[model samples]
Target: MNLDSIKQSLSLWPTELWLLFITLLGLVLASFINVVIYRLPLILRREWGETNLPEISLSWPSSHCPKCKTPLSWRHNLPLVSWLIQQGCCVKCKQKISLQYPLVELAGGSLALLIAWRFGANLSSLVYLGFALSLLALAVIDAQTQLLPDKITLPLVWAGLTWHWVFSSSQMFDQAFLGALLGYLSLWSLFWVFKLLTGREGMGYGDFKLLAAIGAWLGAPALVPVVMLASISGLLVALVLKLNAKWQGQALPFGPHLVIGCLVLLIGGQELAGWLGLGAWLEITSWAF
Candidate 1:
């Protein structure tokens, strides 16, 4: 069959099968994201000052049980499937694996399914899928390690700019570039001001970059709305954590809240606003691609 014929044949597949395919794709990607979430922080810490730590990169030190260091074979390495098969315990040491692995995979798959449903099976689906996953990974990593490596955030910022410059029909590069600048400066300014007032840093530099990436992808008009959404959601969560006995003293990470704001704007921007009676406010901000 010609390429066009193949495309037509593929497009005619039942919606269920397409959903399954998208979910599997997302699971595979999320599996790798789990690796990054676990290992990236170690790699960064080693780079910073942990000279005594063993040399390791994403490609190096192959996957293994962190507790007992047993190598995992392909059979036990499948994403959600393997987790279910193994019942969340290591084959050799019987060490319990964190529930996070399968949870992240599930989140990734569901998010992918939602994106495919929203954007359709097109190149935009692929792009936004990757973007959303990247944000998810960063959120989890930040929640755990409280560090947002420039490695991820910088690339994301640049990727957003490049996407607009190359493919975006309505979003212009100038808006993206300025969005990034304003996003970074907005948090950075707050950081310094809070520090000046209390003699302590209130947030990390990673937050500034993460917001910049969001702004870059969503545009300058999105800055205020995104921050508002992030702050509200983040503060609510923080309050909950404070009320909990165990989490009262722990520092809360803001990156995840910022990620939530970005996703909300990216996925449900106009419709969600309208539903919540923020249509006029959202329109006044003109938050759109």
Candidate 2:
């Protein structure tokens, strides 16, 4: 019942049992992520239509099989397990389902377990878990659709702020707030400058907000480096896709890079700063050179 008792029980549990639990939890979260990924766009469209724009809904009525009108049963909805058991086909219509569903669930579970192993049972652990799950959802959604829905991004911003206030110290809070402001303003400035210079949009407003959320979680000092790291990673991904002869205008999601950067930060931000000479060494090098 108590925290200590729970912790003790967890420690006493076999590694396999712990892993199974984490995997099940991850699968459940991923199942909900399917809904979020599917519905966020529609919700946004509806909101846009309500504001007087004519955008059609993504899905009307309820979630019925596209091939058959029969509703899915609880037994058919068991995340990756159900899909695996059913051979990735609908039971009613026997239509093949995309592997993305199970893959997302597996990725979510694996990432959750990894974060738990890294951070343990502290508040930081919970934050890391939430961060990983959100990133998993964001990455899948962004890859499937070029859009990064505000339904996720805005809540991520609030979650970061909430975590800082509730779990971190005043110093951490200060860093997070400053990070959010600088992160948002920095991109906004770049967008204006790039547009003015080239008559083109370099990035989206959603990216700015997402980075702000990262800032709130990581800190102000991390903003520029994270942006730089993400840019480089994004370029590499773009290059690979383009080399394979993908369209020039194909949208590349910036969310994954941010997620990767934050994960790096979570795992070893201080060490990375030292290696990159972003701290005392950088100042010394600048002065000497």
Candidate 3:
């Protein structure tokens, strides 16, 4: 068959098949992300003198049980299925594994499916899928450890700017640059003001960087709604934790809420703006850019 005919034939495959493939790919990525979420912090801690350990890179040490350090075979490393098969325990050590493994896999699969459903087979879809996955990893890491490494956040900022410059006609590079600057400054200014008045840090510098990365992707027009949605969600979560006595007077990390907001804007920013009676504002801002 001619190349065009082959392309047409491939396109004719069922959407279900494509979605299933995306979901499986997402699960695999999630497995890797689990390793990242678990290891990146330790690696950083070691660098910062918080821990004494041999140099460990993400790729050097194969997947293994933390308690027993037994290298996992392929059967034990099959993402969610393996976890289920083992009943969330190590096959050799019988030690209970954290539910985070399966949970991250499930989230990754769900996000991938959603991206596929929304954008179909397109470059934009793949780009957004990657962004969503990064956010997922950052959210989980920050929630567990209250830290967002510059390694991920800095690369994400550059990636966003590069993506728009190369692929997007609607969003210009300057807009992304301004969005990043403003996004970082907004939170950073708030943090200092709050600290100056109350003598307590309101949020970490990592939160600022995360928002800046989001702005770089979505542009300045998106910053307000993202922050608004994030603040509301964060407040609700904090209140819930406080009521449940789970807060323990510790400040909750804001990165997850920011990730949620960024995802919301990514998936349906125009609709959200319309719902909030800010459709005109977004339109005006788009025109200005």
Candidate 4:
């Protein structure tokens, strides 16, 4: 077809087709997310002044069964399909796989669809899709191990600042910068205050940076609601754990709650804020840049 005809043909494509494409891309990336979640921690453990840890990396190890150490064939690594077909067992050793694999893929796929629907077919959609995936990885990592890798959260801070500078208004960029600064400072201050009073560190530096990265995206005005949501969710869960005899005294990580708070605020900002009685605060602060 000629150039004009080709352009016209592409434009004639249906919305469902675009959705399918985005969903497939998300699923493919989810496989990689699994790799990052598993290996990134090991890599970090190795790097933190440990001389004997075996070398590992996101790209070098290649996909394999963690138990068997056998490399997976292409068919064996097909996102959610492989897990289902194999009954969540390693093909070589018949080792039962963690349910995390398929769940992450599903979450990634759903996130892709949400981004496509919310932001539509545009650069913001792509940017936010990747952002969402990073948050997903962070949430899972923190929930499982209570560790948030600086490798991910640190770059997230810079990425948010860069994204705004390139694609957002100057005012928005300013908000992002302010958000990062205020985000880190606010949490850092709280952490030290708690430590001083109780002779215990209430949270980690990773949480400070995670909030800072969030601020970089949603701006300083958004910080109050984000923190409030995170605190409330975290408190509720803490209460439940404290009440349970078996789970009492378990330390809860705040990073995953922060991620959940950020996503909920991002996707349902106006409505959610109103429900939480923060709508007036959001408006007074001009929550958007």
Candidate 5:
């Protein structure tokens, strides 16, 4: 067969190699998100002087059953497969698994595949794949722990800036730079204003950084719409929780809201922006008007 035919044949194979790669990649990321979800808060706390970094390295301790303290085996650690096989129980101690493990793996893999399909083979796609995974981990970690780790959020910001400079030196760079600045400043200002009025801390600084990361990937113009979308989603979530009586005094992390907003922007920001006529509307509605 000719080279084009050979390429087409591989592309048409029953199991695309890229899909398989993403599936395997998802499991690996899920395993690590488990670690990040658990440890990121601790790391953040240490950095903020709220707590001392434990003298014991978090990693020296192997992955162990929280219930039984029995070390998990490689067989048990096989991501989604192991969870299915073991019926969501510890193989060694038979302790019931949280089901979070498989769920996170599945989410990560599915999202990765989605991104791959959307962007295809390119530098933006790769960075975005990582971005989606990081956001997923942050969203889950914040939901469970009410904390967003600087370790992850900061690196993401840097990655966004660096990725923009490396791959897209023109408009992409401008978008990323403006996005990062606007994303951070807008939230940071809102936080202070809210605190001044309400006499309560409204959100964490890490939330700003997460938005900044979004700006880095998408651009500054995305900030307004993203925040608006997030606000609407958050209100709905809060209302649901309140009605359900699941809303204790516990503060909801804003990270997930921002993640959802960013995802929306990533997929359809331009269309949404055009439909809303956001720029012109803002100009007309400004106090100067």
Candidate 6:
């Protein structure tokens, strides 16, 4: 069918149907993202070390129970349902499975449904959904390993700039470019300054690139809110950890907080800014520019 005909047919469907479709799509993608979260770091490490570690790619080495090494059949691979069916245990070995799988899938599905509802069934929704999934994957990976591979972050930066340049009407190319520049520079400057003052590193270069990618997508106006929100979230988490005696001297990953910040900004940035009284400051700054 022609594109117009397809659009017309889609328009006829109920909103719930579209939401369900996107949620299902998100669940499937989240399963794949699970593979990525587990494998990408290993792949990067192997590549860096120039070692042969059985050549594991995302597609290679079919999904299996890590404890049992048994390849999963279709029945066992269903996103959130299969885990519930088996009661969160490997069917073969009866070993308990990590809850991460179901949680990630649920998060992915919810985010997809939210995007579908917010942006409708449009290219913009699809693109932002992809961006949100990437951020989710990055956050989880960083939380576990304290690493954000360039494989993901670098492409995200390029994709953000390309999306804004080609598809964005609200943000100009110059704004996107400046956003990226400032996002990276702002973090980079802070990194060095903090290191100089405290003789310890506060954050990593990956964070700078991640923010740059965010800036490219949301433009320069988003940088302040994103950073502020991330900082506040991080501080709260840190305080909780400290109070609970779980705080370690080891570095905590900041990517997850930043990802949360990006999502907040993307979903309701203007409303949030207005509520916080930053809207006036933003307007005054724009006037100065």
Query: TM-scores of the models, in the given order?
Result: 0.91, 0.81, 0.91, 0.92, 0.83, 0.92
**Model with the higher lDDT, candidate 4 or 5:** 4
Q: Write model 3 residue lDDT over 65-86, tens digit each, in one string.
A: 9999999988999989999999
Stretches of candidate 5 exceeding 4 Å from the true structure = 1-15, 43-59, 268-289
lDDT of each: 0.85, 0.71, 0.86, 0.88, 0.75, 0.86
Quote the lDDT for 88 in model 6. Answer: 97
lDDT of 6: 0.86
Model 6 / residue 152 / CA error / Å = 0.5
Please write out the lDDT profile of model 4 over residues 1-289, one tens digit for every residue: 6756654654565778867888898999988999999988888888887768769888987788889899988999999999999999999999899999999999999988877776665566667889889999999999988998899999999999999998788888999999999999999999999999999998989999999999998888889888888988999999888888898586789999999899878776677788989888878877664
The prediction achieving the highest lDDT against the true structure is 4
The candidate 2 region of ten consecutive residues with least summed lDDT is 280-289
Q: List the residue pairs that clash in candidate 6.
A: none
lDDT of 5 by residue, 54-122 (tens): 532347567778689798778878878888988888877887988777788888787777665665544
Q: Select the stronger candidate by TM-score from 1 and 2.
A: 1
Report the C-alpha lDDT of model 2 over 81-153, residue by residue, as the tens digit.
8998999888888998877778878877777777666655444555667777787777667676666777777
Clashes of 3: 0
Pitting candidate 3 against candidate 6, the one with the higher lDDT is 3
Which parts of model 3 are misplaced by more than 4 Å?
A: 1-14, 287-289
How does model 6 score by TM-score? 0.92
Candidate scoring better on lDDT of 1 and 5: 1
Name the lDDT value of residue 3 in candidate 3. Answer: 51
Worst 10-residue lDDT window for candidate 3 reads: 3-12
Cα deviation of 242 in candidate 4 (Å)?
3.0
Q: Any idea what lDDT model 3 has?
A: 0.86
For each of the candidates, the C-alpha root-mean-square deviation to the true structure, in angstroms, is 2.6, 4.9, 3.0, 3.2, 5.6, 2.6
Minimum summed lDDT over a 10-residue window in model 5 is located at 280-289
